[model samples]
Target: MNKEEANQTQAGKEQKAPKEMDANDLPKVTAFQDEATREYMVSTKEVEPGYYLLESKSKKIRMLFPEEGKYSDLLSNFSKNEEIIGFDEYDKEANILMNGQITYYQGQSFLRKTDTMIEIISGKNKYSEEYQKENKDNTEISIGYKKSNFDNLDRKNNYSYRYFGFVKPNQSLDEGVEYSFIFTCKDDNQSCSLDEKIARDKVKKMISSIQFSCNKEE
Candidate 1:
């Protein structure tokens, strides 16, 4: 080709290069950084013994016992002090709490004794007498325990322990929302009825007073 034609051809190729380039070859551009964006990250601050502030996404939740040692120790002690009767396993498949054969439906929280009784705590509206009646007809009688403070009482049997049953709300539990429940049962002969009642009352009072704080940024 002639020199002049070759030069023109090269210029045309260069002009088209910009349009033909892939997205990765484009000049780097960035959205301007803002002070507000930095605020989205969570911040840590000590609130008190066994509590720390966690700030994130313009919101804050007081993380109880941020330090592993302190937090774990508190949990251990609490378990020991509260004579935990039993734990309800989380049934992911059923989306409910399971204790042996008894399956408390979702939204219905309870603390109960094996073959004794179950104490329905929150979400009572979801619980129906008909459901209980139908379920009770089975050979296994799922006894429901009432709210009690069996945790602080002296250990009388291998089975006696404090327990809290919770059924998380359909909506997410807000950061500041607090929950509390209890479980207690009488001996086989119902001999500890009076003592159990007193202990349960004390626990109910203590749990009712638990307060939660929510601090989310505007």
Candidate 2:
């Protein structure tokens, strides 16, 4: 083809370029920065470097590194031995907890003394036998959202699950800090209705899309 004809054809193709995708399709995320902590939340994607973030009316997470043995930084503290300071917000009147802490230890005794928990839920088994047996063939790890339901361990009105197992900063496993997360509503009769189920699902969706990074600034 002639140079002039090729130029014209290229111009025509440029004019016919595809339309831009909607912002909704990309997953909307909001960033949160506090004096000692910073995090991000996505409507559809985890705010990342870590696994997930929980959606709640109130959001706060504290990252800490003990001067002693194993430590965790803000940028990479999923289930590491390092001490992390995070809490679950609760609606006292409704008796609803926004996100439950699955990790039982912060790796430092002194730090744990200063950090108090709002709520702590315990289970009988470390991992659900039924769930492990059912998905024995699946080697790939499963990340859950509102639709993903793990073992509740026969707890009435409780939605329980495990966070992505402890991922070290170097991405090597020394000790698995695989923690669990839970959502439950406290009612007069101790039963979860459709409303409670829906509420938990919303929180789960928030958790699935949660991600974070370190704020290195002093």
Candidate 3:
């Protein structure tokens, strides 16, 4: 090829080559910049009994309540190695709600608030072993919620939130186990009392409406 043509070809190749991006030139991209980009954001229809859905700027997660145990496993997973700051328990009949604090690397964090409800059905005293003899299983249900404040050194009070639901039984059943429904809501609002009340009311309505009977049995 001619020298001029060769030079032109080299220039074209250089122009087509990708430009190098320096650290300064890299675009600053934030995670989940758009809510629609989230992988698991819960929709109104996805919300159901015995489930907890949590969302953050970049992450969304859901926890489903199994059919018998309290919130012990749920709390364990959530607060693994974290410090406990506040804890309170309230018992009414066969139900219980426990609220507490969990601390992680980011200083004192709030549990937002937690509620655990347990119901015992078809269980007997250890001495009698009646539930086992009667071929019945012990059923328990629980729900937990946690709200964490965002770790912002510049901002005074920014926060994020999480929720958990669980259920377990003494014995696995051939039929699907019954689960207690639980739901939680978190926002920038500082009034825990109002938020707690609303969350409780909503969850209660959900639980009350659930039908555990099988279609065949019906």
- lDDT per model vs. reference: 0.27, 0.31, 0.28
**Tens-digit per-residue lDDT, 1-218, candidate 2:** 99999999977654431223233443222222221222222232343442333321122222221111111133233444443334444445555544433232334433232111111111222333222111111111222223234365455554533332221111212211223344456453544443544554443333332221211123
Stretch of 10 with least lDDT, candidate 3: 124-133
Candidate 2 clashing pairs?
Answer: 46-209, 47-210, 47-211, 48-211, 52-210, 53-210, 71-82, 72-82, 102-180
Model 1 spans with C-alpha error above 4 angstroms: 1-158, 167-172, 176-194, 215-218
lDDT of 3 by residue, 154-215 (tens): 54334323233322322322222222222222222333322445545544333233222222
Most accurate candidate by lDDT: 2
Clashes of 2: 9
Which scores higher on TM-score, 2 or 3?
Answer: 2
Q: What's the best-to-worst order under lDDT?
A: 2, 3, 1
Q: Model 2 compared with the native: what TM-score? A: 0.31
Indicate the worst ten consecutive residues by lDDT in candidate 1: 29-38
**Shift of residue 194 alpha carbon in model 3, Å:** 6.1
Number of clashing pairs per prediction, in order: 17, 9, 11
Better of 1 and 2 by lDDT: 2
Most accurate candidate by TM-score: 2
